[model samples]
Target: MTSTALPRPPIKGSRTQPIVAGLVTSLVGYTSSFAVVLTGLKAVGASDAQAASGLFALTIAMAICAVGLAWFTKRPITIAWSTPGAALLAGAAAVNFGWSEAVGAFIMTGVLIAATGAIPWLGRLLAAIPVSLAQAMLAGVLLQLCLAPFVALSTIPVYVAPVIVVWLIFLRLSPRWAVPAAMAAALGIAGFAMGQAGTTFLVGELLPTLHVTAPVFSLEAFMAITLPLFVVTMASQNVPGVAVLASFGYKTPWRASMISTGIGSSVAALFGGHAINLAAISAALAAGHEAGEDRSRRWIAAVSSGIFYILLGLASTAITALASASPTGLLEAAAGLALLGTLGAAASSALSDPTSRMSSLVAFLIAGSGLSFAGIGGAFWALLAGLAVRFVIERKRH
Candidate 1:
């Protein structure tokens, strides 16, 4: 009698599962990044179309590099929009630059990122960041984003809160289904109900309009945009992103990650993409669940996510169309709610380690404060405060 083949080791979950997970996570990642880019461009004197172009570049670049790195590493290496970096760019641009200057800044940022990645010592230094501090940094980066759903509810409760609640409940029981289900439900409910009620939400177009602005090379723009951009990407985005990977079982060398990020940012910037970095929250999505059990197959998730991001970038018009099709409240609420799991996970990790608990909490609070000075955001301060506190404590003990 032929024995029934036992179920193959569940080394990898459903092949499609990772792709879907990546897509959901990417939706949030890309949208969050694009929002900052779009608004930033507007604030910096870019026309609507120019802003869209910048966003288009960013999305396409993120997709290409993220997918490429993930494919190369065979790990869940996701790319993100560099939210903190964008904020810095926005403030700097508003103060002293036009679109050309902004593009120049973007170019400088790309070069810096690429250089850091190529340097051997930088990778080692990144590796030395404490696990708890890394986790705290991750939490700090994501804090505002995670809270946006409830914040949205404050402005539009009827449309957003219900959807958020339903999505949260769905997430608890069937996380795999939660994102898509939330997305579908949010759009269907909000679009129809809001349409009948005759309210408008700000959802952009699916196909993005391309606006090519020549880059103006200037020392001032370079200093303002590039230097700060690199700092934030390293401190706010990549450091925490690496930490997340380390927190999980994947200890791939930092050289590849840094190199990929640097190269991706540089290449993307040439085409107007703001800055691309390793995804922290979205990486958690791919890393968590059964999709992550097999390191080899996990690369597929990142690859697929990159493909989706590139497609989204290319079809900016189409992306805006799809997003615009949904009610604004619904779309924002969906992204905000989807990130709920990641927010909770990072927060837990940050505070869980006994020795670093206070320091981590301090980091989390400072990062979440949303304080900015001279176009710089709280990420730098948060890291500084936490590091200073940790140093003092360590010194005293010794």
Candidate 2:
């Protein structure tokens, strides 16, 4: 059983802090990375309608998961869409197939995630994978996306510069709010440009809608999307999320959390979402002392955060429209800035293991190279090449 901090009894008026903490958690989590999520969906073949649907689907699914799992496990087990996996998707080499195949890959990824929880050996196998290599793959995937802000400076300095300025200012003053501040500034730019262009949002587009597609399985997509997506989400989000909660004295109900997120991911894939998993970077807001000193009451914060995300889902279309209206590099700069920290962390960890350094470097190089073979993408090749190098290095030692 998971160790949700046991409480003496319910205290009057103690709920207020956790409820507000939940609100802050959802607001920060959603604002910080929605651009990356939308960009990734589009990169993988989602049309505007489908991408909005995917955003809505992810928000709602994870919200449901956050509420359900928190109630079931009575821990601050917040759920979030896999932002790093979305970055991987954003950096993915273009595929020959379309959205339906991407959806199929999402389904397979969900199955693999659930299998990791349900089947004992699968989780062990994932644990056996070297951490340096996994992080190297992630760092490689982030390289191009992280470079977007600098690239924008050369081409569209007029539009992207202010957003970066806002981010830098906040990075010094309040690092937690840096990306969201940049996003708000980017949206402001989009709104101002819309006025200059004399363009008005359609009343209908302000509301969200679901656009479901029948999934189509393909071997190339499985190789290109599914494996990489699964590995990245597990390595980056779910595993670290558990660790974060553990640091705060909560033992996440592992099997239940995995099953809940995996099922949520599968359901969301039909509506065009790529994937959702345990909240990684954003989990602390709800679980931390800011929520309450009464640790047992912190699950209240997670549940309320889920409710807030469901409300946020209502604006998926509006946000998508606003972002699509923005000057291209402006929105991209926001996404890139949001990922910069993660890139630094992953790169640092990837290089930390001295013996594994060569293999990690190989993975990082190959993944960033954008090489493709027979329709499969660079990410798959990067992992394979890194593993092969690691094997040879170990054999030599023997």
Candidate 3:
């Protein structure tokens, strides 16, 4: 007897899922961090046009690097703005250096980051940073930003509560869409509030306008802005980004990626953008099973993300204007909600190991204290404090 055979399921193409994943990743990453970037740029004396141009330049540079590197390496290689570096800038915005000096500092930072690839030991030194300390420092840098939502709720409940509630609901229902959903809610609420208040929230030109700032270097700017920015971008962003790729069984081209990011940062600096580097959180979306079942085909996801990033760059003028129109508290709340996951992950990683617990705690405390000395930020001091504790403790044991 012949048995009837069931028809085989139609095969799905490799490109579709990866492309979707890429687009989603780009949207989430840009929405989650662009506000912080705008705030940071303004703190460093960037005008509205300059800040918009900076974002536009950054997006284009990252898009090129992400797409080119992913295609060349045949692996998902996502690039992102240096969130920690931006946070540092927010804190140091009052520094005497003008916007030109900040631009100069950015260029120097790019040169230093690129040089790490040429000087292999520099990359190794960054890798040698203790994981616990690194995590602690990252957690500390993220603490203030993560607290923004609660702060907004306390101060502006009428505007922020709805946004936070929406975020929490979506977070439980669909984790991947949580931040984007929250951002949409915020925009809607803000728009309604503005309308009620009889405010015209005008979006400027849809196309990006270029703003060029000349670099003016000084030792103070270098020590304060350049050094700290370089450290955070490398230690906090690049190292973790590489580790993420490696964890997913991809052979990361560490030196090559660093070099590419350095060049991208330098080019972006001309347009007032800060540093761009390997992405940590968003990289997972493109590199993992979310992109595709087959690892080899996942590079397409990163490429797709890059393409979308360029589109976002083209729309930076409108985005910048929207950000300007929104209540600052509401924007902060959205950013804070988006970073909650990252904060939790960093805290867990920082305190997980018994051997490094004390040191990590010290680092977290010192960094979270927000103390600055000799123009250098707390993040640097936190690293030093943690290493000192580790060193002294290890020496006694020996």
Q: TM-scores of the models, in the given order?
A: 0.66, 0.96, 0.89
Name every residue pair that clashes in candidate 3: none
Per-residue lDDT of model 1, residues 191-213, tens digit only: 57657767553445434666667
TM-score of 3: 0.89
Best by lDDT: 2
Ranking by TM-score: 2, 3, 1
lDDT (Cα, tens digit) per residue for candidate 2, span 1-398: 78887777866557698999899899999999999999899998998889999999999999999999999778998999999999999887466778899999999999889888899899999997888888899999899999999999999898899999999999999998999999999999998887888889779878999988899999999999999999999999999999999999999888888887898899999999999999988899989987887888899999999999999999999998888888878777789999999999999999997888998999999888887788887888989999999898854863
Q: Which candidate is the best by TM-score?
A: 2
Q: List the pairs of residues colliding in candidate 2.
A: none
Evaluated at residue 218, the lDDT of candidate 3 is 84
The C-alpha RMSD in Å for every predicted model, in order, reads 6.1, 4.2, 3.5
Candidate 3 lDDT tens digits, 1-398: 89999997644766598999999889988877787787778878898889999999999999999999999999999999997787767666546668999899999999999999879887678667787787787788778878888998778898889888888898899987888888888878777766777876444465688888989988878876887688778877888898899889987797899899999999999999999999988999999989988787999999999999998788788777766777768877777777778779888999998878889999898877777777566776788888999998843654
lDDT of 1 at 371: 59
